[model samples]
Target: MLTHPTLNQLHALGLHGMAKAFVDIQASGDAASLGHAEWLALLLEREASLRHDKRLSARLRYAKLRQQACVEDIDYRTPRGLDRALFAQLAEGSWIDAHANLLICGPAGVGKSWLASALGNKACRDNRTVLYQRVPRLFSELALARGDGRHQRLLRALGRVDLLILDDWGLEPLDAAARHDLLEILEDRYGRRSTIVTSQLPVDQWHALIGDPTYADAVLDRLVHNAHRLELSGESLRRVRAQQAARTA
Candidate 1:
């Protein structure tokens, strides 16, 4: 019979999940039908599952995904010019472990951000720390961090995330400060963490967009060297979807 002392001990050891399972089993008298080994296994399994769930929830919360998209929920049927094989490979998350980056480029409203968010969501589910922020917003936040004298702190946070998704790249011009800030962020994560960038401009135009050849060289050197490029080609998905909806209505 399970007793109060046993439950208290389980809770003390930070096995609250198991402790609750034990209490439930005792109340139901279900443990009486199981052998000692089986009962212990059941308790341990419950504890493991509970911890896994809690950890995943925490990762997702911290991810701050813009679209709440998942790899499984991707609209592969929408003709967004994505390579299914490449996406399938990325879903395995091996590139993350290898410290590789992903560069996704496409026109506006073509699901570039959604794909990046989906990849980020998958990273969170894989128990990896992730952050999703627009490139403009990231620069703004960095500026604020500098104002508050927490610039290094913010950069460190960005550096330590297992996967960083920067959306809307090339949508806005970057000043000298923004370029240097971006370089610092990338320099910290280079060869240590993975990054996912979604840009409306082609890779060839990035240097010109950065507006500084030297900084562009330094930044792209770290990013493109060990990156997997996904050059998406398609029309505005939003417009197409709207047309389809109108026809249905």
Candidate 2:
């Protein structure tokens, strides 16, 4: 058993995970005990795991989440009106598989964006493609893309993602172009993809935010209908944390 030649062959064939596992098992003196079949199985498992990890890393990078949050780290004790059972069900990702929508509404600093990001993170972990964009910034980018000839391409990319997180929604009223763009984006995704929207304004106020009765009706029809709603309420978590820190200091 010439180990160097075998390792070189594995590396040359791009079996990096198996190659590293071989080295580790050889160093651990496990190679002498394990049969050839067992050794092959272990190597294959390591390679699959490595590939899965790489894919997850790429998905997370593509997600571009606004916060480093996870479902496991969610503060259930924070006195917000989060429904644990419903959220648990949501975390299983059935809603996403069904191409449904999630709406999270709360005042500023109430963790609306954070909760949305957590769901986005979970979707990435579940091997689903996700894209995170703040509504205002996304509209701005869409406007610029129109001038740069990337408008349709960008929309197509947005449409293709498995889950799209639109954070900070209704931060500013949409202008005519923005309103049209919103409808276009939503219409493209309607019943075909899942979307998570976080907003300071309630769903009732969304129509006014869009500014045009026609486009507003179209946008809300696509977004509000068949969407799961989570309305959070409490004092700002930021302020509470700052007060606690000051007292401790």
Candidate 3:
């Protein structure tokens, strides 16, 4: 019974999954058929699965993926010049294990952000922490952090994430403060954390986009040199989707 002291104890100990399984097994009268080892294994497996789902849910919530997207949802039929074999390799998440970065650069609307978000979602599903932030908004937050004296804390948090997706990179020009903040972030995350940068600008132009030559060198040094590149091409996927919708309509 829910009123039982043992059930209460299980709840108190935060073993809700096990407690629920116990109740279900008892109600189903499986205790007579299941050996002790079998019952124990069932309970433990339920608890483990529940815990994994909870962790994944928390990570996805914190990730702010915007589209609730996943890798399988990607539209490979759009002829985006994407390399299926290479993306297949990336889907395995070995790049993250190597602490390498990803550069997704292309014109607007080709699903750069979507691809990055898919990768981020995959990272979350794999039990790795991920954060998705647009570069412009992230810079604004960093500036605010500096004003509120939480700049270092923000950098530390970014450093701890298993994968960081900086979407909409090169959307705006970076001033001195933003340049410095970007450099600081890259420096902290360099060689230890993996990042996925989705930018409309090519990597070659990132230098001018960052403004200061020195900061550009430092930031790109930490980010670009060792990174894997995925340059999305062809017309924007949004246009393609819209055309498809119109035809259906």
Candidate 4:
């Protein structure tokens, strides 16, 4: 067999994975023992794996998650009131498929943002599109978009993602423009896509934070209903870790 010619053809066809697999198999001592069918199957499998990895890489890059967290790395032993069973179910991503929302509420340093990022990471792994944005920054960007006439285009992009993660919600009360923009984004995504929100404030206070009775009701109606809640309460993890380091030193 003309190995170099075969390799050239594979490379020309952009089958990089298959070409690499072919080289590896050629180097193996048992290459002659495999049947033709087995060799073809191995090449196809490598090609599929390579494509999957490329797709996942693109999804993660687009997500721009706030934290590099994964569900597998979650600290269940931290006593932060994270429900293992519920999170495990959520990790399976059925809720995302159903277009439901997830609310992670806790005080500062209780891993609210981290948990939301972990879920976003999981969604990317599940082959779902995701976008992460801090609430304050998102509003600022939206305001800028409005001024530059990119407002509707930006909102449409936000709405199209499979999972939109809003981290650090309720950092401050929303002004009129922010309130209206938020409603627009949520309304666009209301029944078509899932959202994960992380907040230092509890859900009940969200209405007040939104600031207008009419907009508040409309926003909450889209977000709070059909949402799963994770209420975490504990001492700050940062404080605990620093104390442990001090004791070790």
Candidate 5:
């Protein structure tokens, strides 16, 4: 049956819209016909390529990307003084193997979230498990967890992802229990999994956001070590876009 020539076989191979007439002629099935074997070969090749494309498409959709998000679309190279080589190195899976984390710090609208989300997208595409959470929303979930007595289970779910992306950090001050939860998540995942954190504030000010000196110090101590840190400096990309629009008008 695999040796027989058929239009369905050719369509399966890759000539996406081959007319039924062509297939009907091919499927006539004369035993000595070389056309059948040729068509079969073509179909086999097309099937392989289509399978590859399907796999790639599945990976992209499984990424669960936010709107207008992707690392490839991010203008990292356009950002002045940003290290492309370092970004490439991190993009490779080896950085995680080395137990290193990534910190994407910059002013608002400077592509910090774009970059972090891009990396998370990459991890997902690589078939590694990932989770994305905004700090405020995640903390709110944690607050609910505490009320429902499922805080530890929730934290464990977070800790288990191969990569975790925490976006918009320092947006709100942490109270004692939230601080403890954050620290515990970091410590538990520390050296076991990797994290990508995006924040508008400087690392020096993280102490201020966490609010408890002792706990903040402990948190910083674990995060800063064995981490690949990138500090971005530039005007807001949104403001730049608006200015360009006005100029065009």
Candidate 6:
């Protein structure tokens, strides 16, 4: 019989407390111990940690990205007038090294979100850290954190993420404090990590949406200074899909 070490010994070896439950079940030879379902459950439980691993999420978000969300899936071979060089940069993973921001600016339905999300998913897959949040959601979380006296903690947490995606930036106007908080977050992460922002409004009008010129300038300076600007100038891929479906019908 294999001798079982005390839980303290496991802890000394850096095993998580949750590992005790698995050990207990295994020792007792419970219904779950030797079953495939139980094995899968244990695997999934371990994966729960990935949700909090920002670096891992960032990499997986990129590596395991869905094909539909990728720019490579779109045909640049045709004379559709898409920016080929930008696509090449994205494909080459240059942004991953430069720690530069990615600005996806274009009209709605032009696959801006798809491309940004794909990149984010790719980052997650590559074992880098990443988080995805809409502009409104991010502001709301920060506001709640501030109200709860955890604003600094929240900012620090955002700073530590390897890649942060702020999607739908122009969906709503930002107030003074919210705009300021955004600026701080951007400045903190400036050249330290990467950020991918998808916006319908052009960079020039970002100040108008931010609602404060000085803060907006400071924010844009950090964001645009070391960023990869990809203007997704194409018709809505959704529209194209619909048209193809109709033609098939």
lDDT of each model, Cα atoms only? 0.91, 0.93, 0.88, 0.94, 0.77, 0.72
Poorest 10 consecutive residues by lDDT, candidate 3: 1-10
TM-scores, in order shown?
0.94, 0.98, 0.95, 0.97, 0.75, 0.69
| CA lDDT, candidate 4, residue 76 | 95
The CA-based lDDT of model 6 is what?
0.72
lDDT of 2 by residue, 1-249 (tens): 789999999999999999999999999998989999999999999999998999999999999999999999998999988899999989989999999999999888899988888999999999999999988899999999999999999999999999999999988888998988888889999999999999989999998888999898899999999899999999899999999999999
lDDT of candidate 5 over 1-249, digit per residue (tens): 543465467557665433343444356764346566775665556655666566757655644545446556757655544678888777776887766788888888887877777787777667677778888988989989998989989999888878888889998899888899999999988889988888999888988889999999889887877788888888888898899999999
Over 4 Å off in model 2, which ranges?
none
Residue-pair clashes per prediction, in order, are 0, 0, 0, 0, 2, 24
Off by over 4 Å in 4: none
Q: How close is candidate 6 to the true structure, as a TM-score?
A: 0.69
Q: What is candidate 1's local distance difference test score?
A: 0.91
In what order do the candidates fall by TM-score, top score first?
2, 4, 3, 1, 5, 6
Candidates sorted by lDDT, best first: 4, 2, 1, 3, 5, 6
Better of 3 and 4 by lDDT: 4
Q: Which ten residues in a row have the lowest lDDT in candidate 6?
A: 62-71
Task: Using lDDT as the measure, name the better of candidate 1 and candidate 4.
Answer: 4
TM accuracy, model 2: 0.98
Native-to-model Cα distance after best TM-score fit, residue 42 in candidate 6, in Å: 24
lDDT of 3 at 89: 87
In the range 1-249, model 4's lDDT, one tens digit per residue, is 788999999999999999999999999966899999999999999999999999999999999998999999998999899999999999999999899999999989989988999999999999999999999999999989988999989999999999999999999999999999889889999989999999989999999999999999999999999999999999999899999999999
lDDT of 1 by residue, 1-249 (tens): 338889989999999889988988888988779999988898999999999999999998888898978899877887777999999999899999999999999889899888888888888888899988889988998988888999999899999999999989998899988999999989999999999999989899998998999999999999988999888887899999899999999
Residue 75 shift from truth in candidate 5, angstroms: 2.2
Kindly list the per-residue Cα lDDT of model 3 for residues 145-217, writing each as its tens digit. 8879999998888888999999888878998888888887788888889999988889999999888888888
